[model samples]
Target: MKNYLFPHIFQPIGWIMFVLSLITGIAIYSSIPVFGAGIAETLAIDSAIIGIALGALFIVCSKERVEDEMTKSIRLASLLNSIYAYVALLVGCTILINGVKFLVFAVFNLVLFPIIFVCNFRLEMHRYNKMCEDEEQD
Candidate 1:
């Protein structure tokens, strides 16, 4: 039963989201007068996909170890990327006493988070599952 449930519950959703984010992030980071420079189709697509994804995640996480572990693990890296960029810019602006654009920060993470996620997610998930297995053995 657990074996049967595993595939239904887990299939690299985090890793998939991470890839989608990278694609969208590149689009946003370009900042090239998209739909006339404020009317953002990019955000619309991204939010819609993310919303669907998050709902799916909750459903899976409610039942499966792998899904829950993968989501939480990838999020740790992604959130840190978000927070790091946000704080770094805020501090840099404060130090320079220069105004900072919110869009800069937005685009920065919109690009970086996925890159970080893709780089770290697979390894993290493997490690986490192994830890779970080890604990179960003990």
Candidate 2:
């Protein structure tokens, strides 16, 4: 089955937003000492979170140039692999950081799942493309 994706333009926009969000998030974290627990700091953090979430969603949902069954299968495999890896990491980290540190780690860990999936998907796609090229050359 074919999968529908966002317009080609969204991919680059998503990447830009993702980077900007990361920067904004870092800046907010850095400013926490100065701002304390005020509404401004809360708003900044919330905005950064929203931006990052939306950016990741756009990137993940964007269609590939060639959205074939093989590509879809690769995507599914990558997602499953990412989930498995994330769960393993979560379990291990829970054991290692069984305190206030775990709470902090968990917040960051939530974002890692999508990042890991995207990375794995890209790697798989690259490998598939290379294999296809090699086959064609043979």
Best by lDDT: 2
The sequence of per-residue lDDT tens digits that candidate 2 reaches over residues 85-107 is: 99999888888897888887876
Best candidate, TM-score: 2
Worst 10 residues of 2 by lDDT: 28-37
What candidate 1 gets wrong by more than 4 Å, as runs, is 1-9, 32-42, 45-98, 101-103, 110-118, 121-138
Note the Cα lDDT for every prediction shown: 0.51, 0.79
Candidate 2 matches the true fold with a TM-score of 0.82
Per-prediction backbone clash count = 0, 0
- Report the C-alpha displacement of residue 65, candidate 1, in angstroms: 9.5
* TM-scores for all predictions: 0.38, 0.82
**RMSD value for candidate 1:** 7.6
Candidate 1: which pairs clash? none
In model 1, which range of ten residues has the least summed lDDT? 1-10
